[model samples]
Target: MKKIKIGIIGGTGGIGRWFAQYFQKEGLEVWVSGRRSGPDLPTMARECPVVIVSVPIAATLSVIEQIGPLMPEEALLTDFTSLKAEPVRAMLRASSCEVIGLHPLFGPEAKTLAGHNVVVCPARSRKWLPFVLDLFRKGRARIIETTPEKHDEWMAQVQVLNHLNTIAMGLALKRSGFQLAELLPVATPAFEAKVEWMKKIFGPNAGLYAQIITHNPFVEDVFENYQESLRELKKWIRRRDDEGLRKRIEQAGLFPAVRMKEE
Candidate 1:
């Protein structure tokens, strides 16, 4: 097997840094690069055969435009942006290289890729497909291939809704004057699990969450549904309608049956 040389643009960011470290651990010649002066990018891409753009969603296209022409002709270019359609379109317009869009469902905090899911949106090449799949397989990551539009639509629920719900839970706790740790003892296992998720969401950069919610078009509907659900819950509580509340609970109970079985 030929050793792969990887270049990561926006290497200063969390995702990019994680990729650089992971690639290095896999014995690949990995180089970290970004727009800022902290690291050397051109030289790195010049030597690497695979280039990954792990910048912000808003900056992804611009970085792609800048890096596309400079990358070696045979280098495989990909991105770690949450929304893929726009980046895929941009890369298609800007470069003739083998472009792909990737979304790692896990965060930089992830210890390993053993159980993690990665979305791969291949654009313009069958030759590089196996190589790309093999790279992720080496880390034991599950690769899910799909179109860029489908990837973004799925992320609206996976990333946006999940994060928004966590944010809402934290907000509710704040407004209710409830200390999270204090509720742990009396909480059910499900509620406790939710609190743990809240802790993870609140622990890190707010900017990442902001980008996820703001950049994805489908997120607005999720937010609207969240607000509507809260309003209905509030109405049910204020009205003290036991029948209505019971019916609502029963409806919620049916949700699990409608959902896909967990792996």
Candidate 2:
């Protein structure tokens, strides 16, 4: 039985490179395409039975538009975009190929997929869905099957809101003219850890983070809710209401394991 060849567009580095190497290790023939190197986009589409778009957020849709029409009907066309809905729609609209939206919930530098979550939005076919899921399972990744819409909705809080708070803290510190070097000496363990995490956001992939925050449709509501919470917290702090602050803290802790029941 001949194994299907997989082509990863933009697979020269980062998650694309990771996927290219990972899939190769899983015994699949993998080809790659990148901006300045590797195989060309049209060539990958025409050659491989499965084409994975592993480009950056800003370039994803345009890449999809380019290769979507070139893919064969039996090809599995998927993407590694953080935000799902738009890319999935683009793939479906532009191609008759099997479409899936995948978002690996960890960075490219992760050593292993063990215990990591991989969200799979199987928008189109059953042909490649099982193959993809089985591969992730073999890698010890937790496979989360979901719709593109629901995935984007949750990512509003997961990625956008989380990045928002991190960026906001870093900005607040900057605006205060507080020297990070001076603060390090007095920083607690949690503060030190948070500072390191904030460095990741401020360091690389700034554009990717920005796109995730701005492009997500549900993010506006997330931002509103976050601001409202901050304002409420400010009111309690301004009044020096010890009991109000304590109650608020306790209320938040009370629902650690609570899940919303489907309505």
Residue ranges of candidate 2 with Cα displaced over 4 Å: 253-263
Give a tens-digit lDDT track for model 2, residues 39-110. Answer: 887789888989999888988999999999999898899999999999999999999989999999998889
Q: List TM-scores for all candidates, in order.
A: 0.85, 0.95
TM-score of 2: 0.95
Q: Of the candidates shown, which would achieve the greatest TM-score relative to the real structure?
A: 2
Local lDDT at 22 for model 1: 84
| Cα misplacement distance, residue 255 of candidate 2 (Å) | 3.5
Clashing pairs in 1: none
Best by lDDT: 2
